[model samples]
Target: MALFAVLSGLSACGLPRSGPTKGEIRAGSVEEQGDTFIVPVTAQVARATAMVPPLGFTNGFLGAGVIGSDVIRPGDVLGLTIWENVDNGLLAGPGMNSTALQEMQVDGDGFIFVPYAGRIQAAGNTPEALRRIITEKLDAQTPDPQVTVARIAGDGATVSVMGGVGGQGVYPIERPTRTLSAMLAKAGGVIIEPEIAQIVVTRGHHTGRVWLKDLYSNPQFDVALRPGDVILVEKDQRNFTAIGATGAQNRVHFETQELSAIEAIAQVGGLSTNAADPTGVFVLRDEDPATANTVLGRTDLIGPQRVAYVLDLTEPSGLFNARDFMIRDGDTVYVTEAPYTRWQKLLGALTGAAGSANSLSKAAGN
Candidate 1:
């Protein structure tokens, strides 16, 4: 009877649990105390929470028209060559009929000085336009002067490319690289996996982002590049935590832009088949007031509410619901241990105690 009592007490003792049981979770959901609300994962809940915000270029970034690449700007270097009709023209050398001028840089004030042509506004004019202007300026002294302007190396109309790209530097916006996609290619493309790569374009005060893959599929996202634009290519940072009775416990990053609950579970190696309770898979997130109201079908909730969305895999529509339910960044996906798992642990403990008593009794008999 003494040995029986000891084993009974051991069985009555609290057993280790992976997480809160389904009933305990439901009981603790009190809106008055600001406790986590237990929202069952229904089709309605899935649809309501599916309204995830999309990432793409804004109107300001998309609506801007492409600028002409050949249009000269300040800081552009020009090489001018002039052929005069007269033997002794204003710019002609003693024995030469033509003159060559190299390294003529456009000043900060958008003016470039030529010996015979005087200071000319070189900025905002194409090379051809500048050539015509210079010819007209020198025509009186040089007699129908023929002028040619060639664009040399310049700092005008450039973009800074950094982060996860093959080459990171300041790239000029030329004819073949006037758009975002073209600029990315000129920078040696994204070094990371295209599916997980994110491209961010910052112009002035406004910024926009899109998936690297989306740039090709969506024409609107392939926005025209602007001067002084900063482009960054990097991996997606969005992730969720997998805990409790899952096969693995870690923060798993999103493999794509949109991640569903089913895919999130799979990424963590799925739930433990032996210990996981099929009826108690929960996704924990802090729901904003607007989203919380939509999920709970109430309006009085204010601020960010702690919400625990429960998914029962044993139900008929369980798989479908999980597939439809989107897993957001910073969410915690937890699976409760099966009820039998705790019972098994308790039974094992009691059996070990009983076996020890029997062994002690046998030793005394000897």
Candidate 2:
């Protein structure tokens, strides 16, 4: 009876097994004990949906009108003009001279000394406000004194632009209507492989990200610039590893731009014909350990989930919109080969048997 049972099990190999079908395999399913199975179809779908790139602005503080404000700092050269009752004439030029009747340079104490005015605070005040203050000081000595203050050297209006831009440096904010794009243009636009969507603006201790596409497309995404604002255009080239059946196995640079899964695959030279498993194409995203630990420790605030996504490209439908899957900064993509790829040696034997069977059948009929 035991021998018969063993033979029955061996014969069952040729028969169809009571398990998942081809559809189930394509849908991402694994057979478990007995008739039970574990299928991550819903999870896979959710992951694919989550992998969709964020469409709009991702960073920076953009709102109506200007927030905070730029202030004057030390080491700035101010062009001072003074009108001395039409007798002293209109004094306008660079630097301070005896005939010029104007003062320049703010002391270490943030004070500028002018003729008739002993010491005045010029730093941290706008040019217009400084003009009014200088006028009031001169008015104490002369009647109806007219004073004008212009920044000769923009050392005071300092702003730092970094990341992705061709030129990253500390530039002067000459105009009040300067926008983010203007700053980038001054820095020579973005460098190669730039993340066009991820731009970060850091002011004091606060930092925010802005999406370039949204900033240009949506009028509401415009934000006024303030002095001392550090604009950092960071590339999102996190720690992404491309492996499996690609033409080249390489790491991608993630700047302030959006990278789709298809693009990432192409960057490595597409898939290798001999080793690629089209159905097993997937991405593994590691959960941010720091964020996950913080969320687990703090229960009061709404914490993010520690989860990753796996993408599959075996389905014919997935090819239609493959670009929609945005590859995160640090993700790993693996392509597997089909299991039946190693069975090519058996094809000749099978072909010969089929031919012989057909010949025998034809001979019998004749």
Candidate that would win on lDDT = 1
Q: In candidate 1, how many clashes are counted?
A: 0
For 13-48, candidate 2 gives per-residue lDDT tens digits of: 442222222343344422222221222223334343
* Shift of residue 3 alpha carbon in model 1, Å: 10
lDDT of 2: 0.59
Write down the lDDT of every candidate, Cα atoms only: 0.87, 0.59
Per-candidate count of clashing residue pairs (backbone under 3 Å):
0, 19
Candidate 1 lDDT, 227-313, residue by residue in tens: 889999999999999998998999899997888998998999888988999889999999889999988889999999899999988
Q: Among all windows of ten consecutive residues in candidate 1, which has the lowest summed lDDT?
A: 6-15
